[model samples]
Each structure stands twice: as structure tokens, then as C-alpha cells.
Target: MKVASFLEDVKFNSNKPSVLMLMDTDFSKELRVVFKKGQIMEDHQAPFAIVVQVIKGAIDFGANEELIQLNDGDLVSLKPHIVHNLSAAEDSVVRLTLSKADSLQRVKNV
Candidate 1:
């Protein structure tokens, strides 16, 4: 049983946003992000699958070129190898859960 929390160190991201990694490991990675207006998460595709939950504020997710607005309480899963990007509409916070390669590969085979 291991527990982790946000780091005190401040890191700036796109649009002057900030971020924190609550947990990052070979098995699974968890991240907590704080987004400023106009902040964008550049386009990226992960080899492993991922789960994203909107913890606060609002965001728009572009998945496979399809756009959808996500508000608080929204949860979505990004399939392995899918092109995805994120942008914040307002000051927001989000949690990302990324699965390891081993687990993602099994799902791909099914």
C-alpha cells in the first residue's frame, strides 16, 4: 500500500498552466493537472491506454480528430495508439490514469 501526493515544486505548461504528478511508475502513472485558459496539451498518442477524468473546470478533448467538450465529473478512456489532444477552456484540474504496456497489449489482442 503506497500513497502519493502532489509535489510542492511548480512546473509551467502550455498557456502558462501548471501541473503535478501524483504518481508515476512502470506499472501505472497518475497525474493531476492545473490548466489555465487557452492552455493546450499538444497532440500525442500513447502506446498504452489511458483514462482521463475532469476533476475541475472544463476542457475539450480531440480524439482521432473528433472534438468533445468535457466538464466536471466527465470521465473518458483513450484507447491505445489513438491520437488525442487536450485544451482548457478555463482554469481547470484533471487527473490522468495511464496503464502500463503489458496491460495495454493484452487489451489490444482481445
Candidate 2:
């Protein structure tokens, strides 16, 4: 069994969001994405589906040409090839779930 905490040793960056791989499960890769206010992960598309959950603070989730406000405890999912992006409404910590087939480098490149 693997154990991890998204909130543990949390850190943020001024120039970009901090991304960390929390664990690699049987079917998915769990990640912790920390964003300071106004930071953004610009529009990008995932080759596989993904799930994103707001663990703390607020975010503006841009997808489907819509800006969705996600507060604490909010979650969103996107299908493969869907273009999306994230903007922090405040200092935020997000939990991201990616398909096992997704590359960690692809996320880091964004």
C-alpha cells in the first residue's frame, strides 16, 4: 500500500505553480498542484482523461470555453483531447488525477 498527503510540506512558487507526483496507483497518477494567487497553467490538452479536485482555496477552471469557479471541495473532470487550463483565484492546492498512460513530463511541460 502507498500512503501520501497532498497538504504535507506544501510549497508554492512565485513564477509558476509547484507540481508534485503524490503516488502512482494501479490505474492513475495522483498529483499535488500548488498555485499562488494569479498563477496559471495555460491552456493545454491531455491525451487521456483527467480529474481535478480543489483541496484548498479557489480557482478559475477554464474548459469548454467556460470559466468555472471552483472553491474548496469542488471537483472537475475532462475527457481526452479536451482543452483546459487553470487560474488561481487565491493561493490554492489542487489534487489532480491522471490516467496511468499520461506522462508526468507532459504535465511538467505545461
Candidate 3:
């Protein structure tokens, strides 16, 4: 068995979001992403489905043309190729899970 603390041992970046990759395997990939207030992740699309959960603080999350405010304990999911973006409303920690192994492999090769 493996164990980790999503809230511990993280280093935040002032210039951009800090990403801590927790796991990557044939079925899924998990990441702990930390964002400082005012930082943003510009619009992007993933070829695979994804799940995002807010662990701490708040964020403005945009998917396609829809925008939603996310707070700690809130979770959201997106279909493949759906454009999405996010900005920190406050310093935040988010857990992102990518669910397509093949797509992740392609991304890693790029």
C-alpha cells in the first residue's frame, strides 16, 4: 500500500502554479496542483476525461463557455477535449485526475 498527504510537503510557486505529480499508471494520473492567488492556468483541452477537486481555498473554473466558482471539497469533471481554464481566487490546492491512460502516454511523449 502507498500513502501520501495531499496537503503536506507542497511548494508553491509565485510565478506560476506548482504541480506535484503523485502518481501515473496505465489507468490514471493524479496530480496535486497548487496555485497562488491571482495565478491562472490558461485555456487548454485534454484529449481524455479529467476530474478536479478543490482541496483548499477557492478558484474560478471555466469549462467551455461556463464559469463556476469552486471551493474546498468541491469536485468537477470534464469530458475529453473540453476546453477549460482556471484562476486562483485565493491560494489553493487542487487535485487533478486524468482518466485516460493512452492519452496521457501521448502527452508524455510530446
- Evaluated at residue 56, the lDDT of candidate 2 is 97
- CA RMSD, predictions in order: 6.3, 0.6, 2.8
Clashes of 3: 0
**Best-performing candidate as measured by lDDT:** 2
Q: Which pairs of residues clash in candidate 2, taking residues 3 or more apart in a chain or in different chains?
A: none
The residue-by-residue lDDT of candidate 3 on 11-58, one tens digit each, is: 888788887677775677787889999989888878778899999989
lDDT tens digits, residues 2-53, model 1? 6874434434465445655576587886777777778887777777778988
Best by TM-score: 2
lDDT of 1 at 89: 87
**Which regions in candidate 2 have their CA more than 4 angstroms from the true location?**
none
Whole-model Cα lDDT per candidate? 0.72, 0.95, 0.83
TM-score versus the correct structure, for each prediction: 0.73, 0.97, 0.88
Lowest lDDT 10-mer window, candidate 1? 101-110
> Which of the two candidates, 1 or 2, achieves a greater lDDT against the reference?
2
Q: After superposing candidate 3, which stretches have Cα over 4 Å from the reference?
A: 100-110
